[model samples]
Target: MIAIDNILVSDDVVREQFVCDLAKCKGGCCEDGDAGAPLEKGELDEINAIYDIVKPYLTPAGIKEIETRGRYQYDREFGWVTPTIEGKMCAYGYRDEKGVIKCGIEQAYYDGKTSWKKPISCHLYPIKISMTKEGEVVNYEPRETMCRPGCIQGKKLKVPVYVFLKEALIRKYGEDFYGVLEQVAGSYFAKAEKQNK
Candidate 1:
């Protein structure tokens, strides 16, 4: 693990490869989970504030689910989560013509309806944050069954998990922290290359 400020980053994030293949997965992560998208405490407020703007883009089913579920809920395992439709697709999800699940919140953001781009948790997917006695521990979740296509694509593109998640990492931790992480990853990979040779 590498420590930067208060965050502990797992080495797997550097060693592993991943890239979301929306065509193959069709945004399955948003629909296949037991619960809805995870949310930070502050995100609740944004959901409420942006619901009006996002509502227009959402499907009728999504709108109904949101109206009934009250935007967010507490899960036994995930704690705070966005409500799901009958424990399936997120209340904020819509399907495109190709049947790819799309985030209504993100659609609104792209449409210039809201400044806050969906939940940070959603943006930083496949990487989950857990609170330890020491600090926040960031780990790459290996949901291989769900993300096989991404794994294949990542290997083909030579994109490590850290590189694939660069934008989200920078969003969660500042650019300086991400830069430091990049340096650490470079050193780690370089050392591995030397040992392998």
Candidate 2:
């Protein structure tokens, strides 16, 4: 587990243009919940404590997934991903009436209610957690591919960093992580500006 309370985004334009495709992309990562994510030792203990309280609503599968796949720390050699669960959607992933894949934990968090009794990894998406040898924490941006050409081209407009960092980014990674991420995003913006010029 890493203790990255901050991320340093290298570009402002990239950050502004970046809108996570929660509805459109529906990356499988969201479905798995925190169980599909890595955690630090203390973070796990905290999550388990929460799990003990919410065990009833949590599925046996969700618990199993978290236990089996829960990474205590980042394995740089393999990269920051867990082994994909064979042919299974994340325990928290379900289709709505319109047949849209939605995340259960995210819904709960936003609605101010408790979701499954599992690790916090299930709640966070797009933001990845990793640890360095000195135990420094690191967070990675989500990997999203361009979906609609119009959506890709539309991002040429400029907006404030606060929009992404203070709002969406904070909602996902907490204030600490966003602080560092904004720094990284700033650098990205500068480089993008240079390229554009």
Candidate 3:
């Protein structure tokens, strides 16, 4: 594990490669999970605040689910999460013209209708975060089947998971933290390369 401040980042985060191949996976992560995307407590308010603006970007089914179930729901396992469409796609998600599932909230953000992009959890996908008594534990947790394309693409492109998730990490931690992580990753890879020689 690489210790950055109080956070403990799993080695896989630096070793394993991953880049979301949305075209191939068709945004399966938004729909395949048992529950909606995990939400931080503060994000609940953000969702509620932006729901009206994001609504038009969503699908009819998603809008109905959100309207009926509320903007977000509580899950025993995941605590707060976006409501799912009949236990399938997320209520905040919609299928694009290409039939790929996409986050309505993100689309709204891209369109400049909202400042918030989406949930941090959604942005930090493939890297699950857990708050421990000591600090935050960050782990690489890509879905084996659904993330295969991304994994392959990452390896082919030689993009480590940390690099691929640089933006999200910076957003979650901060630029300073990301810079330290990059230094750690550089040392980690260099040592491995030397050992292989």
Candidate 4:
């Protein structure tokens, strides 16, 4: 584990490789999970506030789910999460012509309707975060079956999990923390190189 500021990050973030192969996965993480997209405390209010602007991008089913259940729901195991449509894809999700699910809120953001792109948890996927008495722990757990193609693609492209998640890391921890993480990754890989030689 490497501690930067109040965060303890797993080394696998640098050791392992991953990049979302959307063609293969079809954004399955948004649809396949038992729970909806995890939400931060403030994200709930943000979603509610921006509902009018984002609603246009959503499907009729998504709109009905949001209207009936509200923006987010509480799951005993997962805390607060975005409500799902028929307990499948997230209420904020929509499918493209290719039948791949995508985030409507992000689509709105891309269209310049709102500044908030999407939930942080959705953005920080492949990296799960947990709060401890000591600090926040950022971990990488390879997904079973679903993420295999992404792993293969990442290996082919030579992208480390940390490198792929640069934007989310910076969003979550700030530039200073990410800079320190880069330093740690540099030293860690250099040491590994020496040990191998």
Judged by TM-score, which candidate is best?
3
Ranking by lDDT: 3, 4, 1, 2
Give the runs in model 1 whose Cα sits over 4 Å from its true position: none
Off by over 4 Å in 3: none
- Residue 128 local lDDT, model 1: 89
lDDT of 1 at 48: 85
Which parts of model 2 are misplaced by more than 4 Å?
A: 1-16, 31-35, 52-87, 115-125, 133-141, 144-197
TM-score of 4: 0.97
Candidate 4 lDDT, 12-60, residue by residue in tens: 9988889999999988888888899888898889988899999999999
Q: What is the TM-score of each candidate against the true structure?
A: 0.96, 0.50, 0.97, 0.97
* lDDT per residue (tens digit) for residues 56-155 in model 3: 8988999898888888899998899999999989888888789899898999999999999999999999999998898999999999999999999999
Q: Which pairs clash in the backbone of model 1?
A: none
Whole-model lDDT, model 1: 0.89
> Candidate 3 clash total?
0
Q: What is the C-alpha RMSD of each candidate to the true structure, in Å?
A: 1.1, 6.6, 0.9, 1.0
Model 4: weakest 10-residue lDDT segment is: 141-150
Candidate 1, residue 96: Cα displacement in angstroms equals 0.7
Best by lDDT: 3
